[model samples]
Structures are given as C-alpha cells and as structure tokens.
Target chain A: MNEPPRLGDLVFTPEEVQKRVKEVGRCISGDYVGKKPVLVVILRGAVYFAVDLTRELSIPFDIDFMSLSPFRPGLQRVEIEMDVDIPLAGKDVLIIEDIIDTGLTVNFLVRTLEKRFPRGIRVCSFLSCPARRIAEVHVHYFCFEIPDVYVVGYGLDFQGYFRNLTGVYTLYDPTGRSTQILKAMGKGGKR
Target chain B: MGDFSIITISREVESLGDEIALRLAKKLAFEIIDREGWVALLREWNTELPVEPPLEEKEQEEWMVTVRTFLREKAEKRGFILLGRGGQRILEGLDSAFHILVVAPIEIRIQRIAEKYNQDRATASRILAEQDMQRERFLMRNFGIDWKNPLYYNLVLNTSFYHIEEAYTLIIEAMRRATNKVPSVPVKQRSLFEEKNFLKERVFFSHPSEEDFARILDFYGIRWLYEPRTFPLVWDEEGNVVEAFAPDFYLPDFDLFIELTTQKQKLTWKKNKKVRRLKELYPDVKIKIIYARDYEHIVRKFGGRK
Candidate 1:
C-alpha cells in the first residue's frame, strides 16, 4: 500500500496561533463591551478554535454548537443537522468557523440566523481563504489570512486527520503545487 | 412568465382602469407609472420630447425604443404598474410583464363621462367618440396595431360587469396565477445547476426511488435529463438486435451519468457488472453508480425517511 503524505513545515506555531487568537478575542471584547454575544461554533471543525477563542474572551457570553449539511432533499437549501439550544432572538450572534472559503456556507448561515430576529450577526473565522471566496461575506474578526492550499491542524483537517495538532500546518502535497504555494508565501522550505 | 414584476393597464376612457391600476398599486405596494411618472422619467433622462411620440415613423420608433428600454430596466429593478403609453405593444413578449385591457359598453362609458365631467348626454357621447377615435388612430399609426384587439392582452376586464374593487382583486389573482405557471419558453440564458426547465413536462419514472432521486437532484438545483441515451453493449450477428444500458439520470452540467441502484447489496452485482462493461466499452464516458447504502446515507444525513 502507498504511504500517506506527512505534514509539511508549520505555517503557524502554537505560540503564534495563541497570540493572534488573543488579539482577536481582545478586539471582540472591546467592540462588544456592554453586550453579551452568543458564540456559535460550527461543529466538527471549529470546535478547537471556538474553545481557544472563547477562553480568551473577558466578557460574559453563551456558547452553542451547530452542524450543517450542504444538501437537503426536496428543498434547495442547506440543512441544519443540529441547531443552537439557546434563544437567538434579540441576542448578538457571532459565528465561529475554523475556516472561511467560498463564503457560501457563511452567507447561508448568516441569512438563516437573520430569520431568528437576532440583534445583529457577524462572522469570526480562524483562517480566511479569500482566494477561494466566491460569495461576498464580511468577516468581522479573523485570526489569519491563508492562501488557497491544503491546510491541516488546529481544528482544520485533511481526510479527517491532523486536527488534534495545536498549530496549523500545510499537508505534504505529492503534486508539489501546495509546496510551491507555501514557498511563494515564504514558508515550508526545509522545516 | 417569471416573477410578477410589471403590469400594463390599457383602458377605454372612464372605464375604471385608472381606478383599478391605482388601487392595485397601493395594495401590492407597487409604483404606478402614469403619464406624469413617464414624463418625469423622460425629463430625468434629459429628453425634451412631448408626452406623445412624434407623428414621423422614425421618431416614433426611436421613442418606442427609449420607452421600452426604460420599462425593461424599471421592471427588472422593481414591480410597477405601467398606465397607457402603448405598453401592451411596447412589451409584447416580456415574460415578467402582465398586460391588462379594460373596457365597458359605450352607453356606460358615456354615462360615466357625463357623471364625472358634469356634461350633458349629447356632449358626453361626442367626447367619448372623439377620444376613442383619437386613441385608435394613435395606436394604429404608431404601433401598426389595433388598440382594441383582445389578442394583445392577457386579460380583459369589463368595468360594467365588475366594481372597481372587484376588478383590481381579480387582476391581482390572475397575475399571481400567470406568474406561478411555468413559462412556455426560456426567458434568459440559464446558468448551470439552476432550476430545471422540464417542469412543464410529465416524466414517467420506472420506479418510485427514481422519482425520489430526481426530486433530490432538483432540490440541489442540478439540471438533469432522465434516461437520455442508451449505450449498446451487445449487438446481434446481423447488427439488427442489441442489448443496451441506460443510466437513470444524466447531469448535463457535470457531463456525468448516474445510475441509481436501490436494490439489496446481493442484487446490485448485476448492475455493477453492466456498469463495468459500459466503462470498458466507452472509456471516455464518465459514470457513477450510487448504491442503496449511499443513497440511504444521503437521506439520513438530510433527516429524510426512506
């Protein structure tokens, strides 16, 4: 059997990731000082980032998890596998995502949440992949802006692995295209 | 034809068409673009032409083009009611526009004119005749169309038979039904994965599962053709007979054929063998076999029952 590719050079170290998350958390705290925001973590990927980011917040907040599937039978819309238990009406909502690419899911989520009559809705993703964005969405807070490459670790995964790692890294690409991209970004050389 | 966007109101003088248009606009929260509104739009475009187009054919055609362009743009932006201005002829084939013509008996129209204008019966009859003649001549000269033709309108309302409120309500209901019906023709260049245009045709599925699968595909806005082609796998010695395989669905957007097998695992081997043979025969044709388990998993994920 062919061996699976190993992890490439680290894109963000544990220390660097924590520092950026803290900065973003502090910014959110400053902006929403008087109000308690509902932090909605998109499941199976954003769990780790949501936990770390929420821990850094100094204000009072409620946390909820949502799981969504892209397709639904007999309906041309995204299906919500799991909904938030808390009442979202008249509450400030902040969607926490591991990554934002294509922006279609975020846009759909925003529109879905808007029907709940929330005071306002915003997005906060750990990584923003603007190169892969096809839908227009405003990211209120993001920790890092990454290129369009196969990224893993820190709640992001490749084939359901490498998500438990504390820091983000690009997966080793057999075709070398990801390596070329990382090199262009001044990373993933020898280490 | 598409969404209920534009409404064109053509009415005989004092036929309650103006009242219907005004009330319908208010009820539907639509903008009523009457002669005043049209003049304002013309002024906004910096055109100093009269409210009516010139008698010359070329100038009138130019005016018609300008008016049509403005009407199309306005209709695309928002729902509005267009009053008069040869709207029926100007937007003859617009799928998003609904054309209405209002009429009443000559005696009723004369009575209305006399009542509304405080004129005598003879004067009212003379005024109605002159106005009707002027309108007929205007339409005939400008558009080369008979203004009173019922064929030009999707609906014709006689105010003598219905009150103003009843007239507008009926119009609103008709507009809704017209908009909901599938368009007889394609209106614009459709993008991939859009709502399928085969809504008007009744598709007969061999199995209920196939129908369910088609519904799921439609939910995702994936355009598909059912059993569009059959590939001959075996031919007779004389080349007159053959065995063939037809995939359940052909997704034109992806250029892929999907064969759905909802049978038990043991029974699916026959289909698998046929798919294998098809791949060997036509190496370039892309095909996928969605097994029963895979379909169940998809349904389960979406919280749907079998």
Candidate 2:
C-alpha cells in the first residue's frame, strides 16, 4: 500500500495567517476609504482567501468572480469560463488573487479590465512566490512573500487536498523525507 | 460600358486614400468595396463565431487570397475604384485598369497623420513609419514588387502640392486620354526581392490579467499564446479523464510553456504532477511554473503605467 504524504515544517501558523490578513485588510481600508472599489476575485482557488480578506475590509465593496482559460495555439483568443457580472466602467477595481505565480494570469486580467475603462486597477494577493515570475503584474496589497516551495492548507492545496489544514505547511514525500534529502539520496546512488 | 473601367490607387501612408477612393467611387457610380465585408462573409463560412483579425501568417495569407478573389469577381461587373492592398499590381493585366500612385513627402505625411488621428507628432510619426513599413513589406512579400516602382503605376501624383479636387481632376483627365485605347499589358515580371519578415503574433485575452500579460509581451516584442491545448497527464482506471493541464502562455520563441500559479497552495501538487507527466511524456518540451512573488515583481516593473 502507498504511504500517506507527510507535511513538512510549518511555515505560517493559523495565528500568523490571521495577523497578516488583518494587517492587509487594515492597509486596504485606509487606502480605499470612500472609494467603494469593486473586488474582483479569480476563482476556484482564491475563493477562500477572498472571503477572509473581504471580512477584514471595513470598506464597502462589491465582489465578483471570473475564470479564464488560455486559448489553444493558432487561435488569438482566450476562453472565459466565467466573467465578472459587475459593470466596471468608471469604477475602481481591486483584483483579489490567492497567489501570484508567473504573473501571466493577473497581467492578462488587468489588461482585459483596462479595456472596460476602469478608473483604476489594483491587485491584492494572500501570498506570493517571487522567483518564478516571467510577466510583470502589479500587486497593490499582499500578506506574505513565501519561498517557491509547494505549500498546502488554509486554502492552498497540494493535489487538490490539504486546503482544510489550519496552517500553511510545506509538503514532503510520503516516505517522511524532505525533498532535499531525497535529492541527496538520488545523487548518492549515481555516485 | 467602355472597356476601360478599373481605376486602382496606390498610396503611401496618410496620402488620403480613403477620401480619394470614396470620391472616385462616387464619381464613377460604382460600389465601394470594403475588404472587411468579404472577411465577414468568409467568417460566416468558416466559424460560427465572428472571426477577429487573423494573427497567424497562414491565416493572414488565406485572408489575402480571399480579398483578391472577392475583388477580382467584383471587377468582372462594371467600373470600380480599387484602393490599397496592391490592387494596382494584382489587376495590372486588365487593359481597362488605370493605376495611380499618390505620394507625399515624409514630413507632410506625418503632419497629416497627426491631425487626422488626433495623435501627437511623435506618436503619429511612429504610426506612419510602422504603416509605411507594413505596406512596403506586404507588397514585396505578396507580389515581389516595389510599391514605389513607377513601372507599376500609370500616373504618380504628388499629393503634397495638390488638393484632393486637383488630384481627382488630374485622374479624370488622364482617364479621358486613355478612354478609347487599350493600354498594352506589360509583361509580368516576378521580382526576386525578399522583404524583411515580420511576425503576426497576437493573443486575445478574456481576463484582465491575461490582457496585461499580452501587453507586456507586446511591449517586449515577445510572442505568446494562452491555453492553446490540453496536455493529458493522468488517466483513470478505465482510461477515462483524470488530470489535464493547460499552461497559460506558450512562448514559441523560447519553446517554453509557462504556467502561472496564482492559486494558493491547494492545487500546486496536482499541477506539478501534471507538469511532471507532461515532461515525462514529451521529453523535449520545456515547462516553467512561476510563483506569486516573481509575478508581483514583474507587475511592479511594467504594470499600471500603460
């Protein structure tokens, strides 16, 4: 039988996550006081982060969700599984993302929303991994800057599991070994 | 109907082709042909959804052929004024065709473009230069012919000095001189000239984030496509669907598939599994996963401004 995957060192405790979220929320509220900016969330993953972030925001803002898929090659279009229902014209928009990877997805989202003639656009993310970025995406609000390690729990998941974990933890091999140890083992075998 | 019926206008950027074409079509009582209408018709035949301006070279070439076929069929009927798209070169064999090249000095063209487009001089200049290059390259690539070659034209008018009315009068007078005579067809010369190739790379975005990505790529002159196809990773017990991954941007020039993970830790493992499978299955394919911090850095550098 296959062994269960082990959770590595705890990176962010539940108390730490709450502290960061409240701090980000306070910052956003202070900045957007009377603007009534719309919060547009990127769905399927950011849903949990969006809810937590929204609860912290004292400012009045509407929320919308959008999902996008890349277009097949040879085609010049992208597929929108779902689009924001709110009209964005002349409105300040705050895009709520769970994480920001290469910045392609958010960059793409920002450009599309610009066409709608929004007065302003900003991005807010729960966490970020800076090393793998290829496209530039402006993020106005964020909680933590984590390393480029696979994390799960508190809405971040590994293999569609572990979102229910209360704290953010690094994922490791099922054999209870850190990835670095496994790498060393493989290198030793070659030697 | 006289044998001479077609009047083709070959013009440089901001030389007033639209104004001249409209007036010429009105005077001759001929239908004003728009290539866009033909494209719409072609779209109806090809796909249910309205097609956008083609981004692929092959697709653009196909559209050009459609344009030629549409114009050729239209010219078979009565007198018509064909504007741009090397109509003069394409229909040069027709004895009834009178080709005119309208040209202005670069300064005059720049000024005209600035005023007409309500753009600043610098922007207008950039636009005019790009348009000029595209036209020149298009003609050279399609017909292996030079746009400025006087041999391809019957009359070359300097639009800088002449008013639109004066230009129109000159064309009418020239038409009268060749009214009853058939201009002998010049032997078709295939030009060996090769124009510089330009990429027709473009991507349409459904989300604002994707749109931002495209702008950055355009600013950097890097070509990208969004989620073009699905790469199947894992199969179910019955070989049914399990996990499939569609990367956000495929940078053809770099031969890399970039998947941006803005998702919290939840699905990264699944995504990694799929990416690993993809690499194992297609060993030559390169894939990269960009996390949130790097993307924020990029956004900080290039986003929010334009």
Candidate 3:
C-alpha cells in the first residue's frame, strides 16, 4: 500500500499564527470601531482562522458561515452550498477566508454578496497569494502574504487530512521542489 | 431551409445579431452554440485546452477542426444555431447548414452601444472601433476571408433598419422559402449592401476611466450591465414627484452594482450621499462606490490602463 503524503516543514508556528491573527483582529476592531461588521467565514478551510481571529476582536460583530461547491471539470457554474442566514443589506460585510489564491473564489463571493446590497463589503484573508492570482480581487486585510507553494495545516488540508494540525506546514514534496521553495522563504527545514 | 439543421450567424458588435439568434433559437426550438456554449463544449471535449479559442495559427487550425467536428456531430442529432467564431467558413459547403451575416450602419451600431453602456457618443465610438477591429482581425486570422463579403453567406441582414422581431420573422420566412426550393440547387447569396456601403463605425463609452474599467472587466470575463437599473431615492407627498439614482455598472454574475467616481474626495460627497440614500430606500440593492484613489489602485493592480 502507498504511504500517505507526509508533512514536510513548518511554515508558520502556532504562536506566529495566533500572534498575527490577534494583530489583524485588533486592526479590524480599530477600523470598525463604531460600526457593527459581519464576519462571513468561508467554510471548511477558513473556520479555524475565523474562530481565532474573531475571538481577538474587541468590538461587537456578527458571524456567519458560507460554503461553495468545489470547481469540477464540465460543471458550468459554481453553486453556493450554504448561505449566511443573516440579512446582509445595510450592513458592513467582511469576508473571512483562509487563503486568497487565484482570487476567483473570493471574487465570486464578493460579487455574490454585492447583490445583497451590503452597506460596504471587503475581504480579509489569513493568507494572500498574489503570485497565483488569475482574478483581480482586492484583499483589504490579510495576516500574511505567501508565495506559490502547496501548504497545509492550520485548517488547510492535503486530501482531507492535516486540519487538526496547529501550525501551517509545507506538504511533503517527493520531488523536493516545495521543500526548497519553503526553505528559501525561511520556513521549512523543521522536520 | 431544405432539410437544413444548422444556421450559422456572424454578426458585428452591437448589431443585435445575438438577440436575433436567441429569438430564432427559441422559435425553432434549436440549440444555440454561441461563445458560452462553445466554451462549455470545449471544456467537455478537452479539459486541458484553454476554453478561449487559441491565438496561434497552427493551434487555431486544430481548434477549428475540433469545433467543426463537434458541430457536425451535434447537427447529426438535432438542429442548432451556430453564432460567430467563423462558423460561416467552418461549415461553408455543408448541405444542411445555411449561413447569415448580420450588420448595421456604423452610426446606428455606435448609438446602440452608447445606449447599452450608458456612455457618450465619443466613448461609444471608441469602444465600437476597438471591438470592430478585434472581430475583423479574428475572422481574417482564423478563416482567411473578409467576413463582410456577402458571398460567403446565403443571407445578409441589415439590422439597422429592421427590429429584432422583424429580423427573426424574415429569417424564418427565408428558411421556409429555402425549404420549398430544389435541394440540389445552390441558394443565391443575397447582399443587403454593396461592398463600399459596408461602412464600419465604432461604439461608445461615458468616460476614459469607465472605458478602462470595462476593459479590465472584459479581460477577466466578468459580465456587466451598464446602468441597468435606477432606484428612487425620494418621493413627493402625492407620490408623483421623484428623485432617483442610477449606478454606473451592474455585474449580473456577482449581483453587485459598482459606481465609479473619478472625482476628488470632496467632490464625491454628493455621489456618496446619493448612494447612502439609495441604500436606505432600496435595502435589498447592493452597491459599491469606487472612488478615484480606489479606482486608480484597481487599475494599477489589473494594469487596466494602456
């Protein structure tokens, strides 16, 4: 039997992640001091980041969750599996995402939410991957900017595994390309 | 229309050609293979190839073959309306397929574009020019023929003078006439205008900033409706008087309305106040204001400006 893909190297330690999340949370609180904002957490991957970041918010805010069907070949449209129960009209909306890569999904989300007539809408992601962006979506707030690399852990997964892991890690690359890239970024080499 | 199962429509931008094709499709109960349909077909056939038609000559040749084969197979099963993508040339000699060329006077096309995009005549003219050049070049490069040459098409339609319903009825009548004709005889090509009379003019845009914004949206394949809807902000005591706000663009895919303001922050207060009032009145309507600085950032990020 083939062995499962191994966790390669630590990209962000638990402490680093928590610290950045807290800082981002503080910034959000400061910026939205007087207004009540809606933190729309993208389901599955972003749940961990949303929970951690929301806990650090000093101001009052409402939380909602949404999930989108994964892109499949031959499927002409992306379907919204779970929609937020809150009425978004006349409310400030801050979409919480684990990663903004390719910008397609977030762009779709923003467009979808825009139809709801939110007072204002913005994106706040845990990680921003500009290198992989195919759709141009503005990330108003982000904790960290990451390079184009396959990363897992901290709610990110590798074939449904590694969500339980506390820190972000590089997925074990047998070809060593990812390991080399991560190491150069001063991340990997921990295992 | 003698046992014809395929109708290929080639149209200039803002010619209402697509609208005519759609109406014909519904009336005839035929599948319409337009850009979106073609993309879907391409995706299903070859998952690796990009959905947009390839630009390289050799690659385009291969792409054309794939498309032609797909169309042939599809026609075998049921009738369909093939819109543009050099369909006229792709199935030129096919017995069951009839080709159409839809055109309009440059001024009329530009006027239509201006109204559709909520832009001024000059801006509309510029857009029309850009789109015409692109279409001309695409046909020239792919099919190696002047698409405007009426000889390639069995019927040439001038939508400038005809309404969409009228055009649709004309096509259906033509098809009925074709059905009565001898199957072995070649249908004579009809030219609505002489070659010299085929004057190509451009479309409209309201502002240079808006034009750039539209280009970015087009580049990303985002569908947008220009000034599609207006919301009432104020009403008189008798409910007869009114104040209203029309957003600049509505993106159907995103369900968002975007209003681009290139004015300075202080100058934008009026627009902002209108937007706030609009939100209060139409709580279900989602709108966003793209201020000058924000617009510049977006343009910079997307390299929208030339």
Candidate 4:
C-alpha cells in the first residue's frame, strides 16, 4: 500500500521564508534607490504577506491598498470588481501578494495598475502554484512554488479557518484530483 | 433601465420609513439595502466590520486594510432603499439611482416611535435623540452632509401630515413621476446653466451690440446666456430711496455690485444728480454703466456673431 502525499512541500521553514523575503527586499531597495515608491498591496489575503515583506525593507516607502474580487453576485463567469480605489499618480508601485494560485488575481491587478500611469510597477508573491495555474502572471520575486492543493495554515485559510498556523499545510479531500494524482503516482519523495 | 442599484431615502424616523421601504421592496420587487447588504452583498472591504476607527497610527494601518477589503466588493446593481446613510452623496451623479427623502413633524415622529417601541413619550424621545445622534454623526463623518437639511432630499414629503398609504403612494408616485423626469438634474431644470460652480471670469462684460459697445471679454468662457440680457438704467440717488443702476446680468455670487463701463458721458445731469445722491449714502454701492460703443465693437470684430 502507498502513503498519501502532502500538497505543500517543505520548500522553506519559517526562518528560511524570512531570509528569502529579506533578499527580495534588498533587491527592491537597490532598484528603487531615489524613486518615490508607493507599495500598493492587494487587500485581504495579501495582508499577512505584505506585512512580512514591508518589514524586511529598510527603505522609507508609503503603502496603499486596493481590493478586487473575481466573484460577484450576478456573474457566473469570473470578472474583476474594483474596490477601495487609490490615486497612484506618478509614484513607483510594487504589489505584494500572498499566493498566485490561478494567477488570475495577479494578472488582473497588474493590467489594471498599469492603466494608472504609475512610474513603474513590479509584483512580489509568497507562493506561485504553477501546476494549478490557469492565468499567467509576471512575478518579480517569490518564496516558493507550491503544488495544486487545498492549502491552509500560515495565514492561508480553508473557509476562513487555519489562518493563524505557523507553517503552511494542505488539507486532504477523498475525491480531490490532487490527492488522486498522488495516489496514481505511488509513494513519491517528501511532500 | 439597467438594474436599479440604489434607493436613497432621506427619512425622518418613526414614520414607518422602515416598513414603507419593506412595502416598497414588495411593491417594486426590490430588497432592503442595510449594513448587512453592504457587507454580504457588496465588496470593497473585508467582511469583518470595524467596531471603531483608530486613534493611533499602527491600528489605523490595519483599519485601512479592512476598509479596502470592504470597497472591493461594493454592490454594482443592488435594489433597495438605503435609509439614512446619506447614500445620495456617495452616488453623486449616477444615472441609475433613485433618491427619495421622507419627513414628518416632531409630534408625529414622537408619537410613532412611542407606539412602535411600546414605550412612553420620554423613552421614545431618548430613543429618537440617540437615533438622531447616530444619523447626524454618520452623515457628518461618513457622508459629509447635513442630514437635517431639506436640500439633501429630492422630494420632501411630510409623514406627520400624511399617512403610510399616502407616503407609499408618494414613494410610488414619486418613483413613477421620477422615471418621467431626468435622472440627475431633472431633464428640464430651472437654472439655465445648472451651474453649481460658476467660476468668475476676469473681464467684466456689461455692454450690448444695440448699445454700440463692442469690447469682448477674452477671459470669460462662452455661455448661451453670455449676451447682454438687460440694459443698464443708471439711477442717481435723488429720492430718499437709494438710487443705483443694476448690472446688465444678475451675478448670483455678489451683492449690490455693478459691471463697470466707459460710458461716463452717457450719464446726463439728471442721472448724475441721482447717482451722486445715491453714492453719498451708500458710497460703496457698485453701479456699472457700460459704454454703448463696446457692444458695437464686439459685433464688428467678431463678424456680428453675438
């Protein structure tokens, strides 16, 4: 009999995650030496990641937020909804995100942010789950590449639970395709 | 035409405004847009409602994060009567919105609340006072509007004098009537320009072509009513009643001011005597007398366009 596999591999422990973010911070600070930078963080899910990323930086920068959702009441197919508008004007902006799962949210945000005529913009994400990616996004810096799974813990939630966990984990579903993929493949290397 | 998004109600409480809104929802087949609707139905901020805004910096930082979350999910095409949030100001000039204000006398409001809450006059009064405080704060802090003012309302119907059926009829009647009317400024409005913020131009234009004054104001933007609408009749304050000339056109911003003109020679001795007497009492009174020649020059220069 084969054992079930974990969705989120041990890409980095909490300490490693912190170090990776610091490296991204150093890269950003060097690039934006004399520019007026406004870090526009996509709200809700990005709050935790944004906090960690900003803390890594030593440079003085302002922060703003915008909220967008693909799901709305009357629409069946996914579409963008803009909320909490900000005036980006001429400042160089950087978007810090938690995860780019489908890459839909990040792509939509970048395209829309470009229309504001910011001096420049780049994206940073904590996780990029490429195997599950449907939409393409250009990420400047990211910590880990996660597998396609129902991820939870480390501020990620499954139905608003498990957001306070110290490390990321995946929940199992009996009928999940990712679980089935693991089963078909047999005992693989560590998650 | 598109799905109705908002129904802004400027109601004086205890007038069955809530019930009427419910009934209107049934009549028009719409839902009541409360705070719950703002959270559950709409997105712009996070789902968690803030108990209080921050007094300090770091706490404020987190508050803003939640605020953006709330805005992200705002209702696109909601159908409901939004009561007392000063919702109209939020929807300045949206074409798809219907705004209605309900009002009533103090006594009737007091009576209604007293009956509904099953409380005496004193408790009802306290409840009303608390509600008014909340509304006042909400309007001032959230919407930046004076809720007590009737100017905030589209159609102010007094519920103290009128019953719910009458009020509802008015709500429906107003809705019916409103549909026929223009959405934003009422298709046919009283103000010619509907000029909310009419910036004053540098040049003073006080002459007409018939008067032969032809100076054109280079700075002033063109308007349909820019032509000299009235002739200046210079009045000298000879009579005990002050004598002064009125400006050719009424400028709503100023008081007792006149447009200047080079037609000093047009003032006859009789007119000059009255002007002198008027100037003596009200030395600062603005009397504009335009030269007949300036109007003629404008017509000649502009190829008789005016």
Candidate topping DockQ: 1
Over A46-69, each residue of candidate 3 has an lDDT whose tens digit, in order, gives 999998998999999999999976
lDDT of 1 by residue, A1-191 (tens): 85755898678888889999999999999999999999999987899999989889999999999988645544654578899999999999999998886465676688679879899999999999886543458999999998866578898776566889999897776667677887888876654
lDDT of each: 0.75, 0.66, 0.75, 0.53
Off by over 4 Å in 4: A1-12, A70-73, A76-86, A173-191, B1-306
Reference-based TM-score, model 2: 0.41
State the lDDT at B83 in candidate 2.
67
Best by lDDT: 1
What is the C-alpha lDDT profile of model 2 across B47-82, one tens digit per residue? Answer: 642233233334445554565565566667766776
**Worst ten-residue run, lDDT, model 3 chain B?**
B192-201
Q: How many angstroms is residue A132 displaced in model 1 relative to the true structure, after the best TM-score fit?
A: 0.8
| lDDT over C-alpha atoms for residue B239 of model 3 | 33
The TM-scores, one per candidate, come to 0.46, 0.41, 0.45, 0.34
Q: Of the pair 1 and 3, which is ahead by TM-score?
A: 1
Two-chain DockQ for each candidate model? 0.08, 0.03, 0.02, 0.01
Candidate 2 CAPRI grade: incorrect
Per-prediction CA RMSD (Å): 20.3, 18.4, 19.0, 28.3
How close is chain A of candidate 2 to the true chain A, as a TM-score? 0.83
